[model samples]
Structures are given as structure tokens and as C-alpha cells.
Target chain A: MIRFDNISKRYPEGRDALQGVSFHLPAGAMAFLTGHSGAGKSTLLKLIALLERATRGQLFLDGENLTRTGKRKVPLVRRKIGMIFQNYRLLFDRTVFDNVALPLVIAGHRHQDIARRVRAALDKVGLLDKERALPITLSGGEQQRVGIARAVVNKPPLLLADEPTGNLDPELSRDIMRLFEEFNRVGVTVLIASHDLDLIARMGHPQLRLHQGRLLNPEVLAPPQ
Target chain B: MRPPAALRVYFLRHVQVALNSLGRLYRAPLASLMTAAVIGIALALPSGLYILTDNLQRLGSQWDGGANLSLFLRHDVSIEQAEALREKLAQWPEIERLRLITPQEALAEFRQLSGFGDTLDILDENPLPAVLALKPAAEATRPEAAAALKQRLQALPQVELAQLDLQWVKRFNALVDIVQRAIWILSALLALAVLLITGNTIRLEIQNRREEIEITKLIGATGAFIRRPFLYSGLWYGFGGALLAALLLALAFVQLNAPVRELAGLYESSFRLHLLEPGQWLLLLLCGALLGLVGAWIAVSRHLATIEPG
Candidate 1:
């Protein structure tokens, strides 16, 4: 669902964040973006999410040109992609249920539909019992699950996670990876950025590895097995 | 037919956000009340001045009908000559009506009012002069017109002195005009002050919720969605300030009404202090709320644009 044609991003201070990166992951494929810290993994995902614009070349999502999309249409495009952050990014002041309902609320769904979908997503993430509990009271892994529930509540076709399991223990990290695999089995495209080589090797997902702002394996189009 | 789903969602979202903003204000009662009190005092000053000027204008206009000129005849002029002069002046178009008070009538009035009846009887001759009390026509009661008529009467050969009794009324009207201008200036400045206070308050709120705003934007929340709550907060501040202002105005009116009425009674006037009409109060509230909305809008547009999901 994502195609980057020789995309290069240069910061205003003349530093290249990504250089001549080209890749394509067909629809219904899940992959890992493996790179060292500051190896431009986040930048690639940001380009796909339209969080940062490419300085050169073109990028496309679902056959639509993202590089040509204007600022006003960015929100509409973003609604099609679910994003999870390493920090969980949950509003600590709100309850778990309220946190998960945010995406549906932003989409202006009917209140009843929002409640049903949010609960279903929470149940999937094993957070049904913590719906009314504040995120501050939840464990790290639980908080990450709340973030996962929020990202999936709207049923976006593409999911992007930036080191989502970075703060969890190995067992909890494995559990989070399993949840992503479950979503992929149902035909949702998933791209996760991470430096956890051990967990990624065990997961056996094709890795779009990057090195020194360049993709080391740009032609790895293997489907998720 | 029931409302469309999108419309219902939009309306419900607004109601939710508005109530949520109000609840936030309730959460910080002291700070909100202090800000609203400042706005209230600012609004009340201009409102009170406006009412005072309006009442003063009404009082001044009430005395417009009493515009009169008094012409005293020369001591050497006989009553017949005085009567002839009065008849001649009475025929002028500017004179609505004129009454000639001869020396005897003047002396009698002075004696009755001055409380010097025995002393006045001790004098062999009366010192009073024939006076013509001239009431100008309604149109000629204007200050300039009456002044011109006074000058003409003073130039008459039979008249020794002429005085326009409407001088004080003209001065009072001028004073009222100046005060009205001052009120306009004050109101404009205070309105600006209200805008700044609300803008600053909303700016701080946006800063406090910066993380929430960034996350909301990341999750595809439109600019309008992010702006709704801040705008509602501004509306609440404006409405609360206006409520407090209205209360202050009502209290001031209550405190001053009795004394004002007593003062008017002392002058044999039936004038009473009047408060704002219902529509005027409604307008003040509307203006307050509008100012708050505009202020919040400005702050939101300026700050929200700079915050992106980096």
C-alpha cells in the first residue's frame, strides 16, 4: 500500500535524514523497519504518515500521490493510517476507555457506534477491564495496549508503530508483537520501526533494514509469512 | 424528519465540548472568577457612565420647555410706555407668549418672597422696575436662537437689561455631550481590555494543553475540533463577566436611586433614575460573549498553526 520512489529528505540545516530511499510494500503485507538509532527509520515512516514532507522524489499511498497532497487534505489522508508511538502517547488524565475512543471521536462517529467499536478494540487488546481506569494507574505494557486499541479502534487500513514495544519487558514485548501479527493476519498492513533485533529475528517478518540514511535492502518485497 | 447523522454528530460534539470547557473553568474557580471580575469592573464603568449620561440628557431636555427671557424696563419709562413696548415686543414671531409685570406687581412679589415686608414698607418709593417675562417659541428655544433674541431685546430703547434664563440649561446640555463622548472612549478602551484579557487567558490554556493538542492533531483532529473547546472557554468568560457587570450595575442603581429621587424631590422635580432596558442588557451580554469568541479565535489561529505532530 506504500511506495516511495527515490525519496530523499534534507533538513533545513543541510543534513540528509533520508537519501535516495525507494521501496514498495504491496497491500496486506506486514514488515519491520530495522535500523540503528538515527538511521532514518522514523523519517521513512514520517514520510508515509505525511508528518514530514520529502525534500525530493515522490511517495504514494494506495495509488494516491502523497507528495502532491496539500496541507488542507493532510488530515483526511492521516485518518487512513493508524499511528502508535514509543511513549504510548496516551493522555494520562483520561480513562482507558476515553483514550481508546479518541480516534472515533475525532472521526465524528455516532456515539453508540463509537462505544461499540472502542469496546471491541479494547477487548482485542485485553484492556476491557481497565476501560475506566486512568492511564497513570496502568502498567507500561497495559498503557501500550491502550495506545494499540486507540490506533485500531477506527479500523484504519495501514498501521504504523514507532518502537511501540521499546519500554516493555521481553515477554510483554513478545505479547505486543503477537497483537500486531494478529491484526496482520486479518489483512491489515503493518510497518513497525524498531532496534530490537532479537525480537524481530524471532518474529521472522521481512525487514526493510536501513543504514546511514539509506535502505540496505530496498528490494525486499517478500510477503508476511 | 430527524436530523442527518452528520448534523447530529456535529451538534452533539459542540455541546459536549462547550460543557467540557465550562467544567474546566469550574475546576479552577478562583482564577476564572478573578479574570471575570476584572472584566466585570471594566464593563461596569462604561455601562454606569452611559446610564448616568442618558439620565442627564433626559433631565436637560425636560427643562427645554421652560426657556424664558426677562427684560427690565428703564426706571424713567412710564407704565404706558412700558405697556406700549411690551405690546410691540409681544408681536415678534420669536415670542411664544409674553406677560408684562408692572412695578407694583414686582414689588408685591419681592415683598412676599424676601421676608422683608416691614423693611420694604419703611421705604417711601418702590425700587422695582417693570419686567417683561418672555417665553420663546418651541423652535426658538435653542441656545443660539435664544441668545440672538436676547441680544435684540437688550438693544431695545425701553429695555435696561435682558437676561436669558436658558443659559444654565444650555451649559448642562453641553456638559452632558462631553460626558457622552468620554463614555464612548471609555467603552472602546474597556472593550479592548476585555479582548486582551480573554486572549491572554486562552493563550495560557493552549500552552498548558500543548501535548493534548499535538496528539489530537496527530490523530486527525481538524483545526476546528481543536479550536472548539478554547472558543467555548472564551464564551464562558465573557458571559460570566457580563453577568457580574449586570449585577454591579443593578447594585449601583439600587444604591443611588433613593438619593437621586430625594434630590429631584427637593427641586420639585418628578424625575427618577432609570436603568437600562431589557434589550440593552441583552445587547451587553451579546457583545461580551462576542468579544470573548473573537479573542479566543485569534489566539487559537495564531498558536495552533505552529504546533505540528513532529
Candidate 2:
């Protein structure tokens, strides 16, 4: 449900972050965006999220032209998508329950709906027992789960994860990937940006590779074993 | 599906967040009280000055009616001529009230009341001149108008000189003018101080919560949404400060009332300190809210933009 056609981005200081990149993903599709650091993977995700405008070329999310979208409408587009970060980005001052309930709160859900949905999302992340615990009291993996729960609480159509398991151990990272897979199986499109080629190989998903701001053909990468 | 309800709910949620912050302040009652007291004193300085100015103006207007000219007739002028002049002066619109005092009558009253009857018996001719005590109209009570009227009265052949009793009133008016100007300048300076205090407080709060804001932005929170709670916090500060100021001013007026009344009683007069009217209270509350909102807006707009999902 996202299309980036010949999109290019260049910083004001003469750095080309993305160069004539194009991609399309159908509804309910899942893919991994693989690249090394400074390989323009974040730039591609930001363009799709409308956090940054492309310097040239057109981009669309669910057939809505994002390249020409006004700044005021960017929030509308963002609300329909969820984002998970490697840092978890949980508010340490709040309980895990409030942290996961945030997206629904931002979407103006009723109090009953917020309570129900937050509980369900926390349940999905296996953090239902730690609902009242503050982020500072939770372990890193637990905090990341809270972030994942928050991302999916609003039931957004698309989920974008920027190195969601970057700080976790191999076992925890695999478990997190399984959580993402479960959501994808339930019809939520998921795009994850990562440098973990081994994890990609284990998952056997379609891979979109970026090198020096250019998209490499997915077919050239050996199929995940 | 309706947007207005959604927007209102959004705003209310932020308001809830703001209330929670205020709850934190309330939890530390003694510190909050001390801080509020300082803000109250800061706010009360200007409000007290404004009340003083208002009362001073009221007292001045009461005595504005006291301005008058005493027109003394020449010793050589006959009683009939003095009577004719008095009648002529009565026709002038500027003269609100007048009374004639013939020389013979003036001397008789002076001798009886002044305890100088033995000294007055040695005089062959009456020393006192016939006088017309003249009160001016309200519009003609200013120093310039009184001086002009004095000059006009002196030009009359029967009149020796017209003494305008405007010295005390002129001095009081000058003092009131200065006090009014000082009130304006002080209010402006104090308002600036209020803005700075609120702005700095909000800035510190933003710094403390920088992580929260960055996290919010990363999770798709809009700038407006992120800025909402801080704005409410500022508003709470302003509202509290203004309420404290109003209370302080009211207490001051209450404390000063008895002494002011006793002093007025010494002059056989009735005077009271004017309490803040309903409209003034509304203005104070509104001022507080606006100060809070503006200060928060400045702090949030400057710092929140620098934070991103890096």
C-alpha cells in the first residue's frame, strides 16, 4: 500500500541520502528493508512516513500522493501508520499501561476503548502482568515490547520498525520477530529496517536492500534458508 | 466520526495531563504556597498601586468642589456698589455659589469670634473689606480656569483683588498625576517580570521532560499535541498567580479600611477604600490566563522543534 517512484533526497550540505529510488508494496505484504548504517534505509522510511519530503519524484501511501501533501496533512497520514524504534521510546515517567495506551489516546479513543485495547495489546506482548510497572522498572526487552504493543494498539494499517531488535539478544530478537510475524499474519503490513542479514535469512521474507542510496534487486540476494 | 468531538476529547486529554502536573505541585503544599506567595507579592505591587490611584482620584474629585475665589471689594466702594457687583457675579455661569460679607458685618463677626474685641475697640475705622466668597462650577475648577476667572474679576472697578483658593488642589492634582504615571510604568515592568518568570519555569519543565517529548514525536505525536500540556501548565501558573494577587489586594484594602475611616472622621468626612469590583476581578483572572498561555507558547515553540526521533 506504499509507492515510491524515482524518489531522490539530498541534504542541503551536498549529501545525497537517497538517489532515484523506487519501490512498491501491495496491501498486507511484509518485507524487510536491509542495509548497513548510512545506506539511506532510514531516509526511505522517512519519505514513506512523510517525515521528510523527497527532493524529486512522487511518493504515495494507499494511493494518496504524499509528495505534494501539505505539512498540516502529514499528521493525518502518520496516524494511519505505526512506528517502533530500537530505543523503545517509552515515557519513563509513565506506567507500561499508559505507554501502550498512548496511540489510542492520540487517536481520541474513548476511555473504555483505551482500557480494553491497551490490555489486549499488552497481552499480545506478554506484558499484561507488568501493566502498572514504569518503563524505568522494566528490562530493555520488556520496554521494547511495550513499544511494539503501543504501535499496534491503534490497529494501524501499516507498521514500520527501525531496528526494532537492535539492542536485544538473539533469542529476544527472534521472539520479537515472531511477534511481528504474528501481526503480519493477521493482515497488518510490516516493513522493518535492519542490518541483521542472518535474522533476515532465518525469516525467509522478501528483502529490499539498499547500498549507497540505490535499491539493489531483491532477486539477486540468495533466498532466505 | 465527528471531528469536533474528537478535537475536544484530544484537548481534554491534554488538560488532564496538565492537571496531573499541577497535582504534583499540590503534593508539595508548603513549597507551592511559598512560590505562590512570591508571585502574589510580585503581582500585588502593581494591583495595589492601581487601587491607590483609583482612590486618590476619587478623593481628589470630592474636594474638586472646594475650589473657589474670594473677591474683596475696594475699601472706598459703597455697600450698594458691592451689592451690585455681587448680583452681577451671580449671573456668570462659572460661579456656582456666592455669599456677600459687608465690612461692618465682617468686623463685628471677627471681634466676637476672634477674641479680639478689646483690640478692635481702639480702631476708628473698620479695617475689613467687603468680600464675596465665590465657588466655581465643576468644569471651571481647574487651576487655569480659576486663574482666568481671578483675572477677569480683578478687572472690575469695585474689586481690589480676587484670591483663587486653588493652591492645595493644584498640588494634590500634580501628586495624583505623578502617581497615575508611576502606576502605569510599574504595571508594565511587573507584567514583563511575570512573563519572564512564567517563561523560565516552563523552559525548565521542558528541559526536564525532553525525553518524553522526543519519544512522543517518534510515536507520531504532532507538535500541537506535544505542546498542549505545557501550555496548560503555564495557564495554571498564571491563574494561580492572579488569584493570589487579587486575594492580597483585598486583604490590604480590608486592613486599611478602619484607619482610613478614622482619619476621614477627624475631618468630619466619610471615606472608604474601594474594593475591587467584579469586572476588575475578571480582568485579573484573564490577565493571569493570558500570561500563562503566552509564556508556555514561547517556551514550547522554541525548544520542542529541536527535538526529533534521532
For A1-225, candidate 2 gives per-residue lDDT tens digits of 887778899988889999988778777988999888999988888888877789999888988999888877777788778898888888887899999988877667888889999999999999999999999988889999999999999998999999999999988999999999999999999999998889878898888899989888744423223
Question: In candidate 1 chain B, what residue range of length 10 has the lowest lDDT sum?
Answer: B57-66
Q: Could you give candidate 2's per-residue lDDT for residues B253-305 as a string of tens digits?
A: 88999999999889877767787789988998888778877977888888878
The lDDT of each candidate is: 0.90, 0.84
Which lDDT tens digits does candidate 1 get at residues A1-225?
998888899989888999998888888999999899889989999998899999998899988999999988888888999999999998988999999999889888888998999999999999898899999999999999999999999999999999998999999999999999999999999999999999999989889999988988866963234
- lDDT score at residue A147, model 1, on the 0-100 scale: 96
The candidate scoring highest on TM-score is: 1
By summed lDDT, the worst window of 10 consecutive residues in model 2 chain A runs over A216-225
Deviation of model 1 at B64, angstroms: 6.8
- What's each prediction's clash count? 0, 0
Best by lDDT: 1
Model 1 CA deviation exceeding 4 Å by range: A222-225, B1-3, B64-166
Q: What is the TM-score of chain A in candidate 2?
A: 0.95
